[model samples]
Target: MLDKKRIDCFTCRHFYITWDRDFRKGCRAMGFKCNEMPSIVVYQNSGVECLRYEPKLPRKQK
Candidate 1:
């Protein structure tokens, strides 16, 4: 048996495609593409260096 899980769109930083309206607009405004999925992976207990640990942006308050 295998355990599988569906990826979450919100959790993914690169889930948005280039053709997506949001990504298109954002890219134009920022002059770059936004990451579409969660690129960082923190270890459960390992105290090792991680190259993919990108800090998440603060959530906007509305």
Candidate 2:
């Protein structure tokens, strides 16, 4: 069983903000938008943690 509690969609590479009234959040890897975090939506419908989650790389300092 996957522990979905520690999953933070904000730190994921695929996470995005849509600016939509209804669906404000989105995932590029899974290709879906939602009012809440995309990971929650995926887990709720699929009954499993998001498998496509990839941590965003840190930006290099100038």
Candidate 3:
């Protein structure tokens, strides 16, 4: 069994939803877009946790 780290791309600041239908998600920090989540792609490629995973800041309501 392959061990997978639990990384949530949506919580990272680099994660962004794209307008493209095929590749809906992208990572600004890595400068790439993919159908899979950025963190998952990074982990699969590098076999390690993402180095640029920065947590998104809480939005302040006006």
Model 2 misplaced stretches (Cα beyond 4 Å): 1-4
Q: Give per-residue CA lDDT, model 3, range 6-51, as digits (tens).
A: 7788899989999999899999999999999888888889887888
- Inter-residue clash pairs, candidate 1: 12-37, 13-35, 13-36, 13-37, 13-38, 14-36, 14-37, 15-36
**Model 2 vs. true fold: TM:** 0.87
- How far is 20's C-alpha from truth in model 2 (Å)? 1.4
- CA error at residue 31 for candidate 3, angstroms: 0.4
Work out the TM-score per prediction: 0.24, 0.87, 0.86
| Alpha-carbon shift of residue 26 in model 1 (angstroms) | 27
lDDT by residue (tens digit), candidate 1, 22-59: 54322221234444432211122233332333334678
Total backbone clashes of model 3?
0
Per-model lDDT: 0.34, 0.88, 0.88
lDDT score, candidate 1: 0.34
Q: TM-score rank, highest first?
A: 2, 3, 1
In candidate 3, position 61 carries an lDDT of: 100
34 Cα displacement, candidate 3 (Å): 0.5
